[model samples]
Target: MLSRLAAPILGIPRPAKRVIVLAVDASLCVLTVWLAYYLRLGEWVKISGEGFWQPQWAVAGSLALALPIFIVNGFYRAIFRYSGLAALMTIIKAVAVYGLLYASIFTAVGLEGVPRTIGLIQPMLLLLTVGASRMLARFWLGGVYQNQLRMATLPRVLIYGAGNAGRQLAAAMANSHEMRVVGFMDDDDRLHGHVLNGLPIYSPADLPSLVSSLHIATVLLAIPSASRYRRNEMIQQMRRAHVEVRTLPSVSELAQGTVSTSDLRELDIDDLLGREPVNPNLLLLGKAIHGKVVLVTGAGGSIGSELCRQILAVGPVELVLVEQSEFALYEIHQELLGRVGEAPVILHPVLASVRDRHLMQDIMRRYRPDTVYHAAAYKHVPLVEHNPVEGIRNNTLGTLVAAEAAAAAGVADFVLISTDKAVRPTNIMGASKRLAEMTLQALSAAGSQTRYSMVRFGNVLGSSGSVVPKFRRQIQDGGPITLTHPEITRYFMTIPEAAQLVIQAGAMAKGGDVFVLDMGSPVKIRDLAVQMIELSGLCLKSPANPDGDIEIRITGLRPGEKLYEELLIGNNPSPTSHPRIMKAHEEFLPWPQLRARLDALETALDATDLDVVEALLTDLVAGFRCESDTPGWNGTATALAANHA
Candidate 1:
């Protein structure tokens, strides 16, 4: 019945609602004055039965003073249901001023038809009635009182901190109709068993029981300042309780210093990794980039774009972005332009493939870049496996062209962005990258003026075609998360950190140095998928929980996909000055020998000779084994060999 009544009131025109409230306040003002007169006289007072002072005049004077004061103080501008403590304070201030004016006229000075005490009594009564009315309207029209009727049906949640962020989050949720916060789960034992903001604080150890008793469907992590390792522990506990988890952004991201529902996000996969990133060596980071002309090939790609961004931050005099795709070049160019902001760095977007040696050399000579970061290559395993010829031409031969161009241009430092897949390769993409690394080593050994180096690491989270965004999209679509294999694992790093480390690694490079980043630990794909689902407030669908929110479908492994990736092919990697980087003492072919083989490979490529290409790739890249099951890859060498004969 209240909601039914409120529905029409809520639908009423704003002007009409304001008039109704004003009329009500006018009535309240008159009523309070009459009551003040009677209470001061200790009997029913007649307005007409007085000399100069009368109750009738008192009521008139009260309405005249209070109503306009309320209006001038912007009292009627407040919506009743939305009025909070600030609004009430406005009312008190307005009434206080009205009370002082009334006292000055009636008591401090002398009013012919007003009792002096009436001024004080009447304003006090008005404040009470006015404050009460606003409260009643908030309870009725705001549906806050009615919300209590169905509170049990709302989804219950527990905040995993008792800090200021958690308290602010609880307050923010108090106004939300979607979820209800029942308690806080803090690791601090002193905070346990205490009540905060009308919610109980419980130990994380009691989470299982609390979840059962309170029926918590979600757990929000409000400890933004907490370390990644601590957050991982809290999330593990939440997973054990079988509840969904969400987290606030890191302290650095929360510059606004406040928490709201909008600030809550799904638990990041990096949070699951629990690896603290090492601070980059400042000198190393700036040695090759600061005040120098820097060029990055494949600048539109994930790692390449990030490398461009970090290079820009290091105050490069000019940054040249070389990309095959026109759209990608425009995007990074525009983004860098936006970030330029008063900086004197000039941006050049060059749309050309790294395969075109003449074009690359022209661009290099024209720019005369101090450092060149070669990130242009085919890195996706399965895609490159299917299109092996193009993959090899791009990843392997492209490196050779870019390195020679940089050398001819007298580039100071040439960094090749290699990958962990290049170590003990099993796919065309890996084999191609290994060959690229070898090309750099060979070039460095051949004694160019350029200092050539390679930085190799594992998968970066959120790269295009990577599993992170794929899983997120699948979860949002509410369905089965696809997994290549349950047992497959890979190292993960944030793109920014990887790019920063790449720059530092390059800066520390001696000629022919192969720097491998310490990719913390391998994360199982199945476990990662499960964490993503749970963090998104979903349950994994399986035989154990048939009523779960999402199902995990194993599609087996893709062609040439490895069970696990490795960072180092050779044993005993030496540590660098930077903790997270290592220098691998890997062997490679001499420049003269490798040059002859490269020439033969190029000739075979130009002739489209599949047999010689495959034979040469296998012979060139050690530990490269082709999977027999890959379509279009099986028996290529035999067919080509027969055709040649």
Candidate 2:
């Protein structure tokens, strides 16, 4: 209670701080002269000489010379709250100015009998006394500020990175009575054993011992310039030591120059995965969709829905959502409506498919959407392998129809959502997507006004049917989570991140371009499943421990499955505005040649000739490959043929 009351007095706002500084300087001047006089004369000598007070004259002379010099240097203008390098420079100037003024006063008053050494000691004492008082004020006021707040019973924290950013954060939290900082943890060995402000720096390697000894509940990450992967690694290490985690925002967010406790946020669960950061091109993304009528097909699916959310921030005039699924479409439509309330953009959720060319044409003519993001397709490899005709129909023919409609409607851009599986595809699904890419490329070359492009990437984390969600569900069920093969690995990204990159790529596309997202190092399926289990605070059930919480089971690879996925079809991908997205320059068929292939594929589909359609699809898609048939594969092919017949 006492400390709380003392805070305001000690805080010393700008006006008060200046007054105190000037008072201290003036007072120090008088004290120095008196001390010099006593030391030189060897007694409390009276200054009166022939009924004139000489010592009084000397005291008055010192104040007159020193006070104006201190004021002129603007020493009082320094804000203690923002004091750092600049503050140090101001102090140096104040000392120099006062020293010169004091020397001049002694000469003018003819007090030349005073030892010259007294002049030297006076300036040193004045600088030390004044500077030391400022430091004391900071310490007292900081304590008072902390006591004012009603703090939570959180554990003491030690932040890593004790540079300018760290020091500022520490100062901001000085009055934070709730979470006390014991010291700083830094990688610089030189910084070890040095005290910053009042906190000591400890080596990062000693965190385990420090956390245990200090009983720290949390460790705040203040290294804003650290790479995302590095930050994740540090956070994981901290988590292993049984400490909770938090982080300061990126340096860019604090460019305006103040670091506040409000900007400190709890570490997100996603940071534990050690994912690399993505740098996006804001201008390129804004150029294509900002204030333009944009439509996303399959707008309810994982990729399509995320595209809608990201595009909303790009300031589209209208966002037309076209989807065949009623529930999925309704969910995204409701979400968007809630977020962009009363904005000029229209969020029209139309229940339609790209296969319905007549319906698509009508909507296109009605809306005249400036850009269309075509994400509608049959994506599951095993499912598409079983139902090849539907796969080819939706993916291959659907893309053809969408591209043609966009061309007829004079749309500005058309982006086909392609897959890494399309590169040297090992499944019918991949082969079909490759055919779709070819269709768009041919259309773009054949005098289409619209800029046609395909953005290819692999499985996104947390998407429907993705391994992460499936593993999560299996772990929840307290049993075995299945994996296709221990060796199977694929490129992964968050759904929103992938979708954002896709939109950015679409915005950068010219005619007949294929953009591949830079999905950093692929993760093995078994390892990913294991990490998910462990992160959920569960142990793996195995021969070593029968009572373990989760069991991982390996299922043989399904048909059309590959051990790994690739992003580019061939060599030499050109870079884009964003480092994470690359444009693949591949050869394409002429309009006439592609048209003939489509006719053949249609005939093969109508006749229920599985072999003919497979051959035609392979001939059209360069570097096409398929895994050997499995039990599910054979059964599905037979059923598909019977249905067509």
Candidate 3:
């Protein structure tokens, strides 16, 4: 019934509502001033008085002065529901101004028995009346936050902090119609059992009970300054209680260095990394990029894109982006342009394959880049194993072409982005990468001016076709997560960190240097999937939980997939200036001999002869053993021998 009566007022435009508030303030000014006179006289009503409630200029002037003063103080500009101490301060100022003006004007008019003390009492009365009026309206009429009250229909949530960020988040949630805040779950014993924002704050140990009692479906982590390990522990506890989880951005991403509703976001997969990222070495970051022309192949790929972003930030003179995919190239190019926003870095997006020798040389000569970051290659194990020919042609031959061009163009520094699988390869993809590294090693040995190096790290978290994103999508789709093997393990790093480490390693390189990055630890694929499922507030389909939301299924390993990945090619590793990067002393064939073998491999590949390709890979790659000599061809050994003959 109240809403029905207020419909007309609510239907008015927002600014028009402020006009209504202005008129209401004028009325209150007159009423409060009259009330002030009564208080000064110390009387309830003058029933038998000759001049009872006499008309006075002071009363008339009260409305005149208060209305303009309130407008000037911007009293009506605040959203009533969201108003706080700032709004109250504005009211105090307006009252003081109106009262002073009223006193001076009415006193000079000498208008009758208005005591001078009434002037002092009137302003204080005005402040109380105006402040109370807005509070009453906000509390009773549901001032713009009426929709927020509708949030009771949605899932109830408990915040996990009771400090400033948590309090602010609770208030902001009160303005959101998507979810409702039930209470706070904090770890501080001092804050336990206290009521904040009219909601109780409970200890973390009480979360399970509170969650059940309140039917809370979500737990928001408003502790932005918390370490990743602590956040993970909290999330694990909440998820174990079978409740969903959300979190705000880190402390640095908060608005004005404080939490805001806009800063609230869902938890990303990286939150599971369980520690802070390492601080990068600035001198190393600037060594290759600052004021130098840098060219990156595969500049549209995941690691490639991150390298481009970081390189652009470090004041590169010009950036040459070489990518084969049209859409991918266009996307990274447009992103760089928008992000750079007219920065002096010259962005050149080249649409050409790294395998094309002529195009590689042409661009290298045209740009005359000082540093070349070669990142192009086929990386997926299963896909590359199935299509070994294309994989070898791209990863192996592409590196040769890019390196040769860089050498011919006198590019001073060259960095090849490599992977851990290249160390002791079981798959065609890894073997191809190993050969690519050797190609660069050979080029560096040929007395080229370019200081060639390779940075080999383990799997990056969000790289294309990596397990993290694949798992995220499966979980989102109500999944039976497919794993290759129960015991498979791989090292993980963030994309930005991988790229930064690669740049740093390249900066510290001499000719033919193979730098192995310090990947933190090897995580079991099975364990990672289990942790992911648990963190998603879902139980695994095992003996304990017969009726679980998600299941992990073992799909036997692919043909070329390895049970473990290794970062080092050999035992010898020399320490570098940076702790996370190490220089490896590995042997490579001289360019004089490598060039001839490359020609033979190219010839064998062009003829579509898989037998020779397999033989060459087995003989040329160190520690590469062939499980079966099957060329995956229709012909038998006799036919293969005759064909080779």
Which one is best on lDDT?
1
lDDT of each: 0.87, 0.79, 0.81
Q: What TM-scores do the predictions have? A: 0.76, 0.63, 0.75
Task: List runs of model 1 lying over 4 Å from the truth.
Answer: 1-154, 544-547, 637-645
- Candidate 3 residues 1-645, lDDT tens each? 775556465667888888888778887777776787778777743322246344355567677788877767777775473256777777777677777787776554445656666667777888898898877777656643465437647889889899889998988777576788889988989988889978998888877787778988878889988988888788777766777777888777775765666776656656776755767999999998999999999999999999999999899999999999999999999999998877799999999999999999999999999999999988988777766778899999999889889888989999999988887798888989999999888887888788989999988887788888798789889998999888999888889888889888999888889999887768888888887777666778877888998888899888777888988868889898887888887777888888888888988777767778878887788877644334453334455445445
Clashing pairs in 2: 146-175
Write one digit per residue (lDDT tens) for candidate 1, span 404-448: 999999999999999999988888899899999999898898887
Taking the tens digit of each residue's C-alpha lDDT, what string does model 2 give over 415-511?
Answer: 9999999998888899989888988888888988899999999988767788766776787688699888889988888887888898889888888
Candidate 1 overall Cα lDDT vs. reference?
0.87
In model 2, the Cα lDDT at residue 415 comes to: 95
- lDDT of candidate model 3 versus the reference: 0.81
Whichever of 1 and 3 has more TM-score, that candidate is 1
Clashes of each: 0, 1, 0
| Order of quality (TM-score) | 1, 3, 2
Off by over 4 Å in 3: 1-149, 255-262, 626-645
